[model samples]
Target: MTLPSAMTFLLGGLLLAGSVLSKENPAELAVPRDTTGKSQWVANHYKRMMALADKSPEKFRIVFVGDSITKKWLDDSGSLWADNFGSEDSPFYALNLGVPGDRTDHVLYRLKAKEDGGLGNLDNPAIQPEVIVLMIGTNNLFPPHDAEQIAGGIGAVAKRLKDLRPDSKLIICSVIPSNSAQKDEELVIPANATLSALAESMGDDVRYLDLFSPFLDGQGKKNTECYEDGLHLNEKGYEVWFSELMPMLKETLGLATEN
Candidate 1:
C-alpha cells in the first residue's frame, strides 16, 4: 500500500519548496521606495503653507518664530517666557509660530505673505505683530547650508520684518546649546555669532540676546541632561531662558514683575 521511494522523495521536496517560498519575499514588496518619495513630497508641501499665513494677520501682539526650539517654548510651564510676555493683563497678544526643523527661509516666506497679501487682505483685517522674538539656524546647520549662510538668511528676514512691521520690536536669540556630548562646537559658535551680528545690525528696534553661556560649561559643550537630546531643552533649560529673558521683557513692555 506504501508509495514508491522516488514518489515519497518528490513529495517531500515539494513541501520544502513551499515552506521556503513562504519564508521569502521580494525586497521591493517589503519596502516600497514610493513611500519615501511620497513622504518627502508631503514635507515639501507642508513647508509651503506658512507663506499663506504670512500675508494674513490675526492681530498678534507678540509672535515667536523659529524651529523646534521656539516651539518647545510653548511646552514650557504656564509661567514660561511666553506667559511672561504678552498676556491679557498685558495688551500684547502673544503667538507662537514655530515649526519643527524650519529654517529662516520659512520665516521669510511667512512674513512676506502675511504682510503683503494673505490674511492682511483689506477685507480680513490681519493684526500686525508689535514684537517678534526670532530664533533659527539650527536646522539649516545639519543640511545644505552652513552657519554663515543660515545667518545671512536670518539677516534678510530681519530686514524684511523691519520693513514690513516698522514699529515692531525684534529680539534675536542665540541658538540654545544642545545637550550633545561630542559638541559640534564649530558649527554652534559660528551660527550663534552670525545671528547675534545680524540682530545688532538692525540697530535700535532690534536686540540680540545670547543665552548659550548659561547652558554650557566653560568648555562650551552642551549640558545634555538639560535637554531631551543635546538639541532641545527641558524644564530646567526653559527656566534658565526665562531668567535671562525677564529683564528684556520688563523693559520692552515697561512692567515690573508681579508679587
Candidate 2:
C-alpha cells in the first residue's frame, strides 16, 4: 500500500499491528509516557511486576490490564485482593499491569515487544495469561473523542492483546461508570455498546464484560457508595466488580483449559 506524501507513519516503540493508532483515532496513538509522578509510578510498578514474573512466572494465571482502576485492585480492594486474587492458596494468581492515566495508546506502548521499548510481558512465555482481562478506555474520554472512537481504541488494544497471547481467552471490559460529569452515561453507554459488538465480531475466544451495570444505583447515577473520589473505586466498589468478575474469571478459566 502506498501512502500519500502528506501522511506520516506511527513509528517507534509501538506495536502497529496491535495498536490504537489511525487517522480517526490518532489521539489514542500508542506511545510511552514519562511524566514526573506518573513516570515514577509506571517504572516502579513495571519493575515490581517484572520481578514477580521472573520469580514465579508460571504462577501468573490472570492478568488485568488497564489504568488506576485496575491497579487499585491490589490497593483499594485491600483484603479482597489478598483473599481472592493472590493469597497463599487462591484460585488463580493475578498480575496487575494497570498504569494510572493510561490511554489505549499508552497500553499499546507497554504491551509492545521488549525490543520495541515496551515491558514485553506479552512476549514472556511464563507471564502469559490463562484468562486476560482488559479494562481500559475511560482515560481516553476527553474532548474530540466520542464513544465510537473510544471503543475503537479499546478494540485495537484487544486485538493487540490477543495477537500477543493467542492461547489466552481475552475479556474486553466496558469502561466502568465514574462520577466525572464529562464521562457520563451519554458517553459511556454507547462506547460499551460498540465494545460489545466489537467483541462478538472478534469471534469465540474473545468476549466483552460490562462494568457499568452493577456499579450503578436505583437513581441511575454513579453510585457514590462505590466510588473513592469521583472516578476510582473504593473497597465497596471492588466488591461490586469482583462479584461479576469472579464468575466470569472461573468460566473463562474453564473454557481456556478445555481448549
Best-matching candidate per TM-score: 2
Q: Report clash pairs, candidate 2.
A: 30-105
Candidate 2 regions exceeding 4 Å error are 1-22, 35-38, 142-144, 255-259
Candidate that scores best on lDDT: 2
- Please give the lDDT score at residue 101 for candidate 2: 81
Error of 2 at 47 (Å): 1.7
TM-score of 2: 0.84
lDDT of 1 by residue, 1-259 (tens): 3579888899999999999986542211111112155457534533443443444356456767777787777675446644654454545556666667666665555555544543221122264666777777666565535556656766776676677667778888887765433334656677678777777766877998887777876676666656766578788877877777767765676667654
Regions of model 1 farther than 4 Å from truth = 1-59, 76-87, 114-125, 179-183, 257-259
Overall local distance difference test of candidate 1 = 0.63
Q: Residue 3 of candidate 2: its Cα lDDT?
A: 68
Q: How big is the positional error of residue 119 in model 1, measured in Å on the Cα after superposition?
A: 9.1
